[model samples]
Target: MKVGVVDYDAGNLKSVQTALAYLGADQFVSADPEELLSADRLVFPGVGDASSAMRVLRSRGLDAVIREFVSRGDPVLGICLGSQIVLERSEEGNVDCLGIVPGASVRFPKERGLKVPHMGWNQVSYQAGHSLFRGIPQGTSFYFVHSYYTQPLRADLVLCESEYGEKFCCGLIAGNLAATQFHPEKSGEYGLKLLSNFLYWDPERNL
Candidate 1:
């Protein structure tokens, strides 16, 4: 299947491309709306600030493009900053987001020696019978580097949780959309497996 890696000027396009390549998937990187909408699947991977990323997405009209794709029952995966932007809003820039899912992004607190940007490896616990967890064990450690985390209004949308000072939504699934707060592309072996599952998963059928 053909995968589309979004290039809205904020995604980690190269590394994502490399990971997909290793998975032997046909993928392309593009900022053009037509090119992205034409793919079978889409990966929105980003590393920059949330507001800046949203701005680029809007400039390219990718926000509407993404929402439309998901509305059509296609699968889309958002990573890192990409994860935050899919929610209703973000505290990073105090800006509204795509709202494809009901949630708000908030920054990690510094109280009790808790770091602002939670960086490093942390174990993720998934909901029972989650397709995204296929071929992957629970409590798998994934690489994370972010200050903001998404708190989806509907708890059912949350597929996985990871702890920092407290628990946070590390993975979310809604209809045909999926997202992760961690950098799966940089998370090593299990990460690759997760991406492979994503490549072949039909969210509608799985649900």
Candidate 2:
């Protein structure tokens, strides 16, 4: 299926594109509103600061475009900072997000005694499995490098949670949209499998 990797100034577009290519997806790098709307699936992959990313999004009117696509029932997958963009708001810089899901992004609490970045490979315990998680071996470890985490207000939206000093939402799904705080590209075979599942999954039939 055709996948549109949103080409934003703050996102890691190339890395994402490489993984999608490996997954054998029909891929295109675009920030064009029409291209995004026409995409079979959309992936927002980003690194770096939240506020700055939002600024770049707002400057080019991507925020409105993304919100529009979500409204139209497009399947979306956001990674890392990209996932934060889907939250209602972020405490990172009091920045507003796409608001496609009910949640607030917050920085990792220092009191937890965990490293701020939470880098390295960590075991991802799957709370539940669906087409998106198909082929993922049990107790799979994925790469994560982020300080902020999303706390979705809707418990039902949370598909999985990962432990880092405490349990936090690592993966969340709402309707046709899915997002992960961890970078699937950096996550090796399991991560690549996740992308492949997204590539073939049909949200309507529940795959």
Candidate 3:
């Protein structure tokens, strides 16, 4: 199936594209609204400042395209910064976001005594029977590099949780949309498996 990787001038496009290529996915990277809407599925991956990212997405009208894609009930996978900006707002830039999922991205508390970025591999505890985690063992470790974590307004939207200084939502799933705070592209075998699962995931049957 053709997969569209949203490109809004954020980082990590190459890695995500490379991973999808390894999976033999028919994919293209574009910010063009029509191109994105034509794909079977969409991968929204990013790494950078949230405000600047939103600025680029809005400038290119990708923000609306993304919402439109989701509204059409097409599958959308969000990663890292891509995951954060899908929420209603982000504390990083104190800016509004796409709001595909009802939530807010907030910075990790410094009072918790952990490093700001919470970099490196961390285990993710996910709910069973979800297609996104299909074939993947529970509590699998995934690569993460971010200071902000998503707090989905609906607890049921959380598909996985991880611990740094404290437990935080690491993955979210709502209908046709699924997102992860961790980078599956950088997480080796398990990471690749996750992407492969996403490729075949049927939101109707899986969600």
Candidate 4:
């Protein structure tokens, strides 16, 4: 199956591409709208500041293309900054986002002794039966590195939660769209399992 990674000029595309290659899936990385829209599935991964990322996507006319792609009912997985971008808005730069997932991205408070960026590995707890977490044991740890967290407005869409200073949504699933605030590509075996599930996930069947 054709799998495409949305380049948008702000993601760890190489790492994601490498993971897909390891999974033996046909994959390509691109910023071109037609290239991405033609893929069987898409991975919208990103890192770096929200406002600037949005600027890059807008400049490339990818913002509209992504929405159109999703409207067609294909699967799109977002990771880290990519996940946050799919939300309604982000407080990071007071920026508006894709709104595919109903939510807002908010910065972690500067509580004393608590680090701004919640980096490193953390366990995720999700209810069973979701394709993305299928066969993956509970409390599986995934790597994370970010100063902001997604607070999905539709709380039922949350697949898992992780704690830093407090609990926050770590994964989200809604029909053909799925996203995670952690970098599954950097999470080792657990990460690989998640990616594999995503590779074969059937949104319609799951529905």
Candidate 5:
């Protein structure tokens, strides 16, 4: 499938591309609107400041395009900072996000006896089934490296949660939009399974 990685001047571009390629996805990477919109699946990933990332996306008018793409029922998988961008707003930025997933992004609590950028392996407690996490076993350990966390407004949409200072929403699925706090690209076999699920994802059957 033509899986296009949204090149929004964020981080982890090469890793994401490599992972998708390894999962047998004929992936494409582009920052152009036409190229991004034409793909079968869109990979909206990032690893940097949310405000700055939003600025870059807005400069190229990608913010609107992403909203349109997902609205049309195209699948979008956001990773790391990409995940946070799905929220309604973020404490890290003045610009509003795509709002595909109803939520706000906030800085992880360092005062709560946890690291800011939670970097390491963590087990997810999958709340329920979704196509993206289809073959991924519950309690599957995925690699995470991020500071901000999403607090989804519609809490019921959270499909999975993982612990750090507290149990935070790790996986979100709302309609055609799906996002994750961890880097599935770096999560080894567990990551591969998640990517594979997305490759052959059928939301209709999944529902």
Candidate 6:
């Protein structure tokens, strides 16, 4: 299957590209909406500021394209900032987002001397039966590098939880959409396994 990695000039495309290459998956990175819409699956990965990213997406008309792709029941994998902006809004720039899911992204509280950007490795607790977690042990650690956390309106959408200073929804799965606050491409072996699972995942059979 051909996988399209959205390149909105704000994502860390190279690393994601390398990971997909390692997996030997057919993939392409592009900013063209038509090319992206042609893929069987899509990976929305991003870094940097949320508002600026939103600006780029809007300028290129990627915002609507992504919504259309997901609406078609095509599989989508969102990473880091990609995950945050897919929600209804983000506190980072107080900007409204794609609203693919009902939620908002909020910055971490500075209480308890916790770091603003919750970097490094942290374990995520997820259902072992989920296709994305197949062949992966429970409580596997994933690499994270974000100051903001996503809060979906519906609690049932959360697929995985993790703690930095407090518990946060690190992953969410809804219909054909799946997203993660952590960078699976940067998380090592288990992370690679997650990507592989995503590549082969059948959204119709999703849990």
Q: Ten-residue segment with the worst summed lDDT in candidate 6?
A: 127-136
- For candidate 2, write residues 1-207 as lDDT tens digits: 689888778856898999998878889988787777788788888988888998888887778777776777777888889888788999999998878899899999888677889998887766465778888866688899999998999888886778899888888888788888898898888899888888877666667
Q: How far is candidate 1 from the true structure (C-alpha RMSD, Å)?
A: 1.0
**TM per candidate:** 0.97, 0.94, 0.98, 0.96, 0.95, 0.97
Best by lDDT: 3
lDDT of 1 by residue, 58-109 (tens): 9998997899879898889999988888999999979999998899999998
Candidate 1 Cα errors over 4 Å, as ranges: none
| Pairs of residues clashing in candidate 3 | none
Candidate 3 accuracy as lDDT: 0.93
Candidate 3 RMSD to the correct structure: 0.9
Q: Report the C-alpha lDDT of model 4 over 1-207, residue by residue, as the tens digit.
A: 899898888856899999999999999999898888889999989999999999999999889777876789888898999889988999988999988889899998886468879999998998577778887888889999999999999878897899887888988777788899999999998899999999998889972
What number of clashing residue pairs does each candidate have, in the order they appear? 0, 0, 0, 0, 0, 0
In terms of lDDT, which candidate is stronger, 3 or 6?
3
Instruction: lDDT winner between 3 and 5, please give it.
Output: 3
Q: What number of backbone clashes does candidate 4 have, counting pairs of residues 3 or more apart or in separate chains? A: 0
lDDT of each: 0.90, 0.83, 0.93, 0.88, 0.84, 0.92
lDDT of 5 by residue, 59-143 (tens): 9989877898787887888888888888888899666987777879988877877767899999998756666787677888999
True-vs-predicted CA distance for residue 58, candidate 3, Å: 0.7
* Model 5: lowest-lDDT 10 consecutive positions: 198-207
Q: What TM-score does candidate 4 get on C-alpha atoms?
A: 0.96
lDDT-superior candidate, 2 or 4: 4
Model 3 / residue 91 / CA error / Å: 0.3
TM-score of candidate 2 relative to the true fold = 0.94
